[model samples]
Target: MITVKAPGKLYIAGEYAVLEPGHPAIIVALDRFITVSVSEATLQGTINSRQYAETDFHWRRSGDQMIFDNRDNPYHYILEAIRVVETLALEMGRPLKIYDLDINSQLEDQGGRKYGLGSSAAVTVATVKALCQFYELPLSRMDFFKLAAIAHFNVQGNGSLGDIAASVFGGWIAYSTFDKDWLRTVLQTNTFGEILASEWPGLKIELLHVPNELELLIGWTGSPASTSRLVDKITIAKFAEHEQYQHFLAESQKCVQKMINGIRNHHLPIVKAEIRHNRQLIKDLGFFSGVTIETPALQELCRIAEDCGGAAKSSGAGGGDCGIVLTDHTVDQARLISAWNQQQITTLPLSVFQLTEASV
Candidate 1:
């Protein structure tokens, strides 16, 4: 059996604005991961994941396509990964074969509540990695990332795909989104192999080093939010408030750029200040767009962290999920966590997942 794992991620700075091409976002991969294991099988292949569903999903290969016994399985990302990887395999003159894929996840809490830790992106990347190993493909990190991004975009159809980058690279990263409009137009005439080999406009991913004096903390609101839904609402608002939206995007870019510099230069003060500034920018965005990007619970979470002399903000689409805090080692972390507990927020113990040379 061949096994692979991908880490979940959180947006540290850039959120909604990162959707625009060339706009930068700072994201970090968490220690939590999604694992996929593949083994050879005869007749039919099975996909089993107790976290998603109880019953096994069966499939058979027909030429270069996969025909599933049941079409209503909750493995859209995984299935897409298989389709794209198999397409690449066939392009390389490799014959298809049946395999059993088993998946396990640690992106959720004890009650199976998702923490908005980019589980879908992690699973997609993990499946792609597992299949690449099973097929013995000579794929590089960038090639693997592009394949997984293509599979994810086919299903999601939106977002910056920064989560996919963090899952692929596994560390603190400064990422700029690619031009989705360009990809959509070129995909009509170009083959997957051609596109994979081509340069994607505005796409950038750089591993970062955090300052040694900084400490990161995560607090879960115990409520999940749909990132796509929030992005959809913001999309509509973007059309209605074009000028204001442009201003938001410009300011977000500036804030994220400074935050990236702070991380790169080991300037903790600038990082903390930019975090607070980004929080306000998102709040103003919610006010004008009527999207409620930050919930009251998230507001409380940030306020408590600020009271403790740290910087905090909603991690992702907001609405509900998790908030991240960045502080110096001198801050009283236990008191901050205890205050969060009083407000019914759960402080999650998570660390950054760094990639080694071998893994890369």
Candidate 2:
């Protein structure tokens, strides 16, 4: 048996703007991980889990296809990972191996509450990693990231794969979105061998350094949000090319650059100012898109964090989910945590996932 693990992820800045090719976003891989175990078993291939055992998935192989007799299942990411690996193996003159996979996650609480920390992305990455190891595929980090991303995009239809990239390469990263038109071309070809033989020019992933004195605290609203749904809503709003959106994109990109420079220089004040500026810019973008990017709880979290002398912003799509706070060592994190608790927002205990091989 082979096992692989991947971390959940969050956005530090540039959430909506990174959907376009040139705009870059900051992402942090979380400490929480999804684990996948692959092995041969006596029964038909099954997805076993402690938290989700009640909703287990079992399928049998028919020729090169995995037949899920009961088709209405929730683990589309896992299912797609399996299919993608199987497709690649068969095309490479290797047999598609049949195996039972056991999956588990620390991203969800016992009460089944999701923390909105990119559980799907983590699972997709872990699943692909296990399959790659099992099949002895000679894949580099970018190659692995692209395969997992294609699996995720096949299921979701749209994404920049920032979360998938973060899960694979942990810690903080500055990432540019892949070219969707080029990705769609590869998808149309549906040939893994072609992907193996080609170099993808549209994808960019870079590791970022965080100041040792910097403190990042995450506050969850105790409610889950849908990133894909929110993206769709913004898409339907059709402000992609609007003049105001261009302004927001331009300004937000500048703020991110400023934050990057501040971190590199260890200038906390500029970092703080740019974070708040980025937050306000994102709030304004929500206004233009007519979506609640900053929900009441998230806004409250930021107010509390700022009151404690830290800079804060709602992370990710932000209808709900977590908000992030950044400050220096002098900030009263205890007071910030207490105030968020008073507002019914739970503070998440997180460390950046630091698997450099995965993330670098």
What are the per-residue Cα lDDT tens digits for candidate 2 across 120-164? 899999999999888888787777788898899999987678999
How accurate locally, in lDDT, is each candidate? 0.92, 0.85
Candidate 2 has its poorest 10 consecutive residues by lDDT at 195-204
Q: List the residue pairs that clash in candidate 2.
A: 169-358, 169-359, 170-359
The segments of candidate 1 whose C-alpha lies over 4 angstroms from its true place after superposition are none
Candidate that would win on lDDT? 1
Residue 219 lDDT in candidate 1: 96
The collision pairs in model 1 are none
lDDT by residue (1-360, candidate 1, tens digit) is: 998889999999989999998789999999999999999999899999969676669988777678886556798999999988988888877888999999999999877899999999999999999998888888888988999998999999999999999999988999999999888887787877888889999999999999999889999999899999999999998999999999999999999999999998999999999999999999999999999889999999999999999999999899999999998876899999999999999998999999886654
- TM-score, cand. 1 vs. native: 0.98
